[model samples]
Structures are given as structure tokens and as C-alpha cells.
Target: MGEVDPAFVQELEHRPKQGIIEAEGLPIIDLSILSSSDATPDHSQALEGLVKQVGNACRDWGFFQVINHRVSMEKREKIFNASGKFFAQPLEEKNKIRRDEKRVLGYYDAEHTKNVRDCVKKLT
Candidate 1:
């Protein structure tokens, strides 16, 4: 909404225009075959298909949703609950894991996208 940072502008200069190229929908990848124990020819074909789908998704969209992943629903729910608990913690507690400016790891409250920046190095 304000003047975009020159560095950010430079970063976007070579990227494709937003919304210029659209895939039919968000890419979805199934991982069931890769996890199967059977090594039949059909399973091999499925695995090959899986690899191609993953590669195309990475090339076209950079990321995609996965189905039939190994993690159980219970573990997924636990992860969600833990995320909620951490996000709900007091500011002082959350700051302990503040991600520094240069690193992409740890936690933060705000995100920057397009040309907007929000500060969130600490919970407050």
C-alpha cells in the first residue's frame, strides 16, 4: 500500500506477473502408492506417476497439498493443538522463539507479502 521497498521490487522484477498463468486449481498430490509395501508393476507405475506429479507441482506452483501422507490423524491433531497452545501463550513466552531478521525458522506474529510488511518479532 506504500512505496514498495527497492530490494523487494528488484526481487519481483524477474518473476512472472501475478495471476498471469493460472493452473486449473491448487495442485494436489497423492502419496499412497509410495507408501505401499507391495512392489507389483502397477505399484511401480503409480510411484512413477507420483514422482511426475510432484515434479510438475514443484515446477509450476512451488508447493502443493498432499494426501495419504504417513502421519496419522492423531499426530496431526496433536500438532494443531500444540500450535494453538503456543500461539495462545503470553507475549513473554512467545518471544523466546522469535525468529531473527535473517533466518526463516522459529515463530513470528506477522508476515509480509506483495509489498506490505507487518512487524512481529515478538508476540506483542
Candidate 2:
């Protein structure tokens, strides 16, 4: 949150930004219907429709928002807080579990776009 490195800003200036879509136009998938166990014809049809919606959303948009997922807000908040704490760690500490060719399930900081380094980080 302090002064960002000028070099980082320069890199961002040259990178293609993600397109923003209006909230109303965004794909918001409802998940409540999938929770029902009734084997009625209507339920089966609705489930099939839901599956198609998810597929289309994934194909057209890289991601889609979900609703009525049934996850409690408290659990969601805890996950967010934990992620914040993890990302807040110093670089060296994060690298202690560095992801590499030999190990595909750990921390990584560099993301490549068309083989070009794009600044990003993740722990898998």
C-alpha cells in the first residue's frame, strides 16, 4: 500500500487489462436448485439447465459468479482472512514451499501470459 515500484507500474502499463462487464450483464449462476433431492421431472430438467448454464458461462467467460451456494458467510470470511494472512507473508517465507517442475503443489509468484511474465501469486 506504500509507493509502488515504478518498474511494476511500467510493466502494468504495457499489459492487457481484464475486460470489465456491467454487473447486470454478468453471469450469476444460482445454486439453490441443485441442492434439492426430489427426482421429479421438473427437478431433472432444472438440473440439466443448470449444468448447461455453468458450461456456457465457463466457455464464454473465464469465470462466473455463484449465488445461493449455501456456504455460511462466516466460513467465507474465514477463508478470505486466511488468504490475506498467507499473501501478507514475506516473499522468502512464501518461497519456502516454492512450486517447481519437480513439485507441482506449492507457492508460485510468477504467472506467464504468452510466455511473458505477469506478476501474480498463488498457493496450490
Using lDDT, give the best candidate's number: 2
Model 2 weakest 10-residue run by lDDT:
15-24
Candidate 1 clashes between residue pairs 3 or more apart in a chain or in different chains = none
Q: Least accurate stretch of 10 residues (summed lDDT) in model 1?
A: 115-124
Residue 78's lDDT within candidate 1 is: 94
- Candidate 1's C-alpha runs over 4 A off are 1-23, 37-49, 101-104, 116-124
Model 1 lDDT at residue 19: 77
- Point to the candidate with the largest TM-score: 2
lDDT of 2 at 79: 90
- In model 2, pairs of residues that clash are none
Candidate 2 local distance difference test against the native: 0.78
> By how many angstroms RMSD does model 2 differ from the true structure?
5.5
TM-score of 1: 0.54
